[model samples]
Target: MSHFIHQHRFPVLLFAIVVVVLAMTYIQPSGKAEAFHTKDELDYFALRSNMDLPIGGNGLFKASGECAGCHGFDEIGFASVDANGNDVNVVDDWRATMMANSARDPFWRAKVSHEIMVNPMHKAAIEDKCTSCHAPQGHYASKFMGESHYSISDMLLDPVAMDGVGCAACHQQSQDSIGLLFSGKLKYTTDVLYGPYDAPPPIFGSPMMAWVGFDAQYGPHVETGDFCAGCHTLVTETIDLNGVLTGNHFVEQATYHEWVNSIYVDDQSCQSCHLPRIEDDVVLSTGYSFLEGRSPYGLHYMVGGNTFILKLLKDNISELMLTANETHFDTVIARTRDLLQNHTLDMELTAEGIEADTARYRVRLFNKAGHKFPSGYPARLAFIEFVVTDAVGDTLFASGLLDEDYNIIDRDEDYEPHYDVINHPSKVQIYEMVMGDVNGDPTTVLLRAAFPIKDNRLTPVGFSTSHFAYDTTLIAGLALTDENFNHIDGVEGSGTDDVHYHIPLNGYDGPLNVSAKVYYQAVPRKWLDEMFDFESDEIDLFRDMFEGADHTPELINEASIVDFVTSVRQPRPTERLKAFPSPTSDGFITIEVPESDRMQVTMFDVSGRMLFNESMIVNRRFPFVVPDKAGVYLIRIESQRAVYTTRVVRQ
Candidate 1:
């Protein structure tokens, strides 16, 4: 019987494949038939014809809402306090995160639309590649089918596709499913829900488990970086405007691979930071059989450094109402800001002897992320803004200042690229990745990106220049190697970059206040504005969706070099100053200094977003202005010799 089955195995498999394809074709929503004119469609057909794996077989992958109904709060809600003391609900927190709204992010929509508009013939592939990660359940459940979800029709046809990285997506990941380079290569089974625990208590009779009907099993892969690599690392195949292959593949975002060679791999996984285990054991839902015995579960609050977009969504909740409620939005926003405050970057400033009235200052930036600083998404960029001021708060020198429209003042008029050292107002040290087309010309459109024009993103610890040597050969026109990006020349072993700035003091005194800020922008003005310039309906739609968003740069961290010596004429005073309305929501602040008249007051929000800095003449009472946001803020009042730091809360 076995021999007979083996002899006819190929034929049976082929028959099954044909049946599945036919069934899928028939089940496809009416008026949503795919057109075959594009190169992507042609490639799809060829691949389908020659594919060894089965296609179009519907799997048991479920939607995020389905899982939430069981694992999260229902009519009877549950809440927990976050680091910021905000009451956080599990469902609300997860829903507000980027993982849940991956399909609904406006920047992503704009980028994908721009890619499709520029490379019309490859739209099918672009959609598939992007949706593979964003809408994994929709794509994988359809058996590696093409174009899981792209438009309103997709959302209407398959709601599961719009769930973003849903519950089933992560739980279903199998060892054999992930590929070497992470771009949504995951195999799954409906009957099994893999987890980090070696032996998850038998949950068969649990109410939630019974509803889901999946056996909980110990899957060690869940705890490794390899699991996150299944989607975090993205690779895109390049296609020229004329529909011809560029013979190049862009390693668009290699966060997973970057971690593999980093020092954190041995001791930490992505979960250690992003999904840190909470010390307290908590029940997800009451009236459940397995609720009481469960140990501390990893916090489902997958917060990341995406404050800009999260805030945008919160402001436009009427239009983009993905979160559970207003409280949920506020919780996620606070959590996002808090996560951004984690060890992302460190800045140190040093000044040498003044020469020719020019102060030579050295600023060193250290990357604390496991991957490249500002990694993931080519549109993201990070830079340092150094400023110097005299005792009277007169700006002596400044670098990396943004114009009114939020464009970084670059030496190049168009701000095409940024440099490292900044000795002049025109220079900005932007750590970013710039892509080039097949002609070696810079382009932001994803499909035409054949090579990197320049990528000076800070490397992680233990980064090897040799591991990425193959990228040089893979690049069509460039003969460059990985040395340009990695700083592993047997000298600088890890992800640290040093930049020197020589500011012309121009007769400025010795007590010049020197301060530097490290800022990060997920989507820069150039990329965002260029996307809107395209004359495509899809692009316009996304542009409209992105209106009123905070596209300006965000302050990641800031540091100031304390002045050691003060001028003898204006001696420093040691007197503590107090600010009134400590927890005021009225946006009114007052600082009182009895001894000092000329004092520098600089205020920064908890996330290091600078409000303003000014030298004020303080008498008995001096009124100050602060941002209208509710949060804890740090107020620094500096005199010639002593500095006073105080915290104020805006209720």
Candidate 2:
């Protein structure tokens, strides 16, 4: 990469030589000390400074116990940065997580804490849209306090900023203040601070290159897609029509500018294929606590289609699901069924794209994705299905549905070829989907979550649809059928695995009798938890909807295709070691190795194993303490092949 950008151009021009080399070593003290430039300083000589502004996550979301001194509070999870022997915490993938209950998202902090008590001027614009992206590294203006809830370190009360986005709120960025994202435009590293160990920083950190949070990553409108468009590009103002503020508008919640006008933005960029670079692990993966000191690695708990938060962080629901008499395992995957298998429903009773005096007839279902066809996270849900037959194939017609605002809508509901988070979101959800009138009873109100939530737009597998209608006799025989399809989990597609029985060739042409196959499923998180009333039985919303009931409705109710490190997998990487430092820093990471080589040290997240160790080896560079409550981890130091990867920065 241009000799790694010309060996980081003179170590980032030495922060313009930190004002003449820290004022010629700032008043004498050369016992070999360096680094510390401003944006606010602190370094009792140099115990690793790292102070490139953001003012200590707004005082650790205004409660400063200094983020568990290394985030290990009440022992939550994810801190396996630098370890000697045993210390792992992704607290079983963040115990009961939604980023550890993003501080209880009851309709998004109870409608912005009730609009910060009847709107205190939109309470810092709803606490800056709920801390940029759930405390995008905490300090959300001292966790907002307007409602009063304390318990900092990963949020307990109104640390509105301490919700999910943690870790010194994004490796604490640099490069002249990462362009001050959000209200600004966007930027991840304008001056470059990427991670994975080039070491030294925190002795008043950043000399243009500050990310020791473990490298591999940015900048230039941050590689366009506007660095994920400052929280997927959105803006919302209130008190419109003469009320003054004039509804500031701006819209986008994740079309990411329709993938920046896509053709995959000419050649992809949102970190090319979603932060991919980990030189082949079937589909990118790495260790040493996420991209640490770089080696073509980047991924770590960054999966897509949200899998309903990876099914509450890995309850797996028995490897997503299966049945049809357990079809003798080997690997088939297709649980709860949503999208993948070619999407189906081609049609031809007359209208192909519909709209000319249609008695309900339209078809063109297609959805493709090497990744991001509603891939993961942003509330996934795919669509399309029109089965209207007549001559003996049975079934007259049918419309899709899953509603309660899960909206599948039917007419075979081809909700724009699928790929979502929002296209309607109950007419734009800012938070209020309770509508219904003709005496259906939802009282009133058309929409509100705050308005503008769903709009995923579609067209990934070539999404492009318009001109609709399918009154198809209201649902002919109703039975595309599915009890528990089969299996094929990892996901990729060509479409068509069974489920194709429509005889409506209303325009057939011989040999084109068309026969196809491709059906698979496993979905049984308790039969989709009966079918959702939702209240969390410790979150098994039928195992978080088979991580989106894959097989496709955009892999409905999704979660966990595993791999938050192999879906809670652990044990592998221990050079018979140890360390010890835990006034219980959350899960307490400190073990020491050298008691007779037979080592093992482990910690896993995304739901599975909690801690592990095979012991013996009392000393080799100890200082382990990471119970959890931060993020990004995976530390394996096996003695077998002599593994020794390192990357730690817990503060």
Candidate 3:
């Protein structure tokens, strides 16, 4: 099972095996500098000019029995809304956003408690990089972290989570139900959650507040796409620099399983294409507007990679417009480049029947749909785009894009234009845990708090503090089995817990173009180049709002001229293809395509992992099967589509 995957840790898998099949027949043109991010004129909001450096607090919330008599409360009864009973007010969708500033920001509670006390179940075991936006569904189910029901006073009674983040996280719900969960049980078994307002008559709020049902079972898991892989998939685990679990592997976030085994989960779902309700006319938010209020139900907004922060958090050019087939940012890279051009694939190898480099076939590509087919925000990167031809089309055996300095692999910044990072290098640890408004000494929350201060979050003022002062270190009262956590067993058991992706599928000979692409950009920058900053909107809002600091100087965004790819054939590959009773103890196998050509029958193994793929059109003689797992496999066949592969051993 030769396997390879990359997310930029340096030269890895040669930039997707050499610049993606020469970027599939070229199509350049995308050039419109100075300020392109228009969902209808977005500017976002700038200041800088006399820009006084610090302000930080007041983004607001504190109240509840005002968050602990004033700035310290954390619960709203686990703050919820789901099971399709929907009026989802996890405190008005976390007011300013960042899930209500997730506990007054201090750089996201000291970079998620310094990546959970430096790892091993302290937290961060994989799930969409920082939990598909911080605890998206709060780990499958347990009614918000369970111990009966989590703490830190609902981060100050959900001051929208001090605007750091909180809106029942990704639209609330509970019952997930896959395996374990006895003792009392009812925590998850399947409920409905699409939050805020997942359309269906009843305009906004009040189909009993618009939706949020429980007790389990709800509409195709809220419309499928696998319920946004339980928080866009950013899991965690692996340890040992003394943390233990030497089995090995770290860095977690599957981007929703790389678009669920690729070829766009048959037909999209993260909201049928990013929050699309079809619209009888669009316009709901009726909490009152016409003048006095507004907000009947449409602003889950959720679209990430932060188009420079929605150009500036939405004024409303129809909410940053676009959807005529989603204009970039995350449709998992235009639905994985239209599922690699409508399932464009081909492969072959033949023995007893003929055609053979000694006959050897093996091709397997299944990125499913997000969950890792390039799910979300974690410095995006996925691999595969092999091409091989012969019988006439010429070419034979190819790899990915490029980079071992051969360059050519910069899909903006390696897909999803993100490049500019620091990621809490290490040293911060004010743990005991007490996100906002704490008075102190209830034994600990990292010892009563107060370091580098400045609060209120969710975009606007931002500020993040703390690397040590954890009030003498109560470390959330210790115990994770007394701090020695571990759990590693995946790739085959297909269970390391969550946030997954495997990546390994190579087998080709003719008319082959097995594909997978999800390159998105707008972040990577040690400095700045977005093709020479186009000039100014304060250098494109300091490179789209603080991406690589020093107030923002610019220069980053390459690709001036790159070409040298050829191999386009209507007919030219066919060394000889066949697949008969050879070794079909009955499971099925018979092929002969000609009526003008167009075939495709695949099966794989030898560690490439694609069980089957079909499309024979019906020329008269076609029978296929053998997929359960008997023994040596690998078979492919394609037509004018010119491709053929071989290898069929079973006994």
Candidate 4:
């Protein structure tokens, strides 16, 4: 009998394996059983398929598709419609946004691969933290099932993970310590779906629970900026090149903190702008005839500054395995472009009058957003494109010109410094943040970033350096010293920048036409140079897509003046005072005056500190010596007629 049992043991083991496989395959939800023949087969299918599977986890969260049946587009009841009777279903609008496709974003995939490639030792930590925000459903659900790490490979195989930032990722978030949880640390409830509205009647709520296995409850925290801060306020731990932790944390992104320091903190929230509210009454879900229309419906557009990625997704819908069609992407793209061009900023270009054969214009940019203009990712940037042309469209002076590849021409090798006055076309006024490594060298790698080498991005209105949150959103580089940057009369929180342009006429004093435009780039070429240098499958895929797409920067705002004549012959009182030997080596400068009345002369350092002030009587030449320091100094000459400010370089 013992010999017979041993001989049949192999057959019994094979039978047990078959039984386990059949149970795993057949024990899925009612509708998903037909999707796979075996557990191994399903994994193989998901690995190759570009489309996201309609599979929810056995843990806390469900895939976004589970909520689509009730909240998606409805032909009969016309649920989730706007004031114009147009369908504004939550699922449809969100399906095409960066938020919905966060996990599927090629750039993000490539960047994750790049980071892991740079620091191979910390691959587990990198993927765990990155997917916590980008692929929250998969990451957290794995954690719920006692898994320590959810890798990029695991995300690719799991349909729930590929759902990116699905409905459950936000709706299932717990109100406990939401805003206080920085980085990807988010707490989710076990079986609850939270919305802005109160608990629904059992008639609708019972069906929702049956369909998605979650009860509908009201969560006021969903509409708060602090709630969004869980992921938006990212603080990453610094790591050395060899993947060792440096014991220092870097504020990779502080968008929420930037908003807290602004005036909009009192009145506006993240949902107010991204998920715009509509006053029209509309039904929240379909298949329920007794459902009453709700007021102040929030559309889930989730619009942001990433039009470049949106276009890439639209162009390669089939390749990316995206659910949204071209038409859906077009709608989101149109709304995003509208938000960027019409609502992001306000620009005014005024001719301050030409002085001494040079055209003087002031370009003032007012940040209209709740946070910084180009907030969030460090790679995003905005720049001024100032052009002075003659009547025949002959370009006289042009700054911030882009080459064929959409790179700003003549940009500094490392990074451009913040400029109060741009006298040369090579000096472009770019509002961007540059990251520095442990050695104070410029770097694109986020893990190696020690601090912000330069962060001159435009601040929002009411931004103050003394605000509690300002340390995380502090302004860096020369912009800190720029008097006209976010300051008025030496007071902070103006939230505007005044860039003065002094273009040389070069003896051609014809009527000049000045055109100034603010251009924005989500992914500038300079930011990609380092990433493209490293070779990987994800990086190569994105490189092909990015290289094939149009690289033109979006025009945020523009202002133009036509047929402007300069009064060079009849110089103003302030224009008459000219300083000879501008770059004075000996610190002694002679100010040639027009023999005017007694004037008030003042000297100020770049930081707006008054260095010297005197009431002097100028006969013809008034000589004065600047400080011994070799730096740029502002000279202000005020007569009874007018006030003039000029910059002098002391060597």
Best-fitting candidate, scored by TM-score: 4
Summarize candidate 2's per-residue lDDT along 84-123 as a digit string, tens digits: 3122222212222334334343324433454344445545
Q: Write the per-residue lDDT of candidate 3 for residues 112-185, one digit (tens) a residue.
A: 44434444353433212343244322322223233234233333332233233332333333436311221112
lDDT for model 1, please: 0.64
Compute the lDDT of residue 363 as modeled in candidate 1.
67
lDDT of model 3 at position 127: 17
Candidate 2: regions farther than 4 A off: 1-57, 61-133, 136-167, 170-296, 299-379, 385-481, 484-498, 506-509, 513-651
C-alpha lDDT of all candidate models, in order? 0.64, 0.31, 0.31, 0.83
The clash count for each model shown is 0, 121, 150, 0
TM per prediction: 0.72, 0.25, 0.23, 0.80
Cα lDDT, model 1, residue 450: 77
lDDT of 2 at 242: 26
Distance (Å) between predicted and true CA of 587, model 2?
52
* Model 3, TM vs. native: 0.23
Candidate 1's displacement at residue 262, Å, is 0.8
- Model 2 RMSD, rounded to 1 decimal: 26.1
Q: How close is candidate 4 to the true structure, as a TM-score?
A: 0.80
Per-residue C-alpha lDDT of model 4 across residues 262-347, encoded as one tens digit per residue: 99888899888899998898888887777888878998989998889999999999888887777778889999999999889987
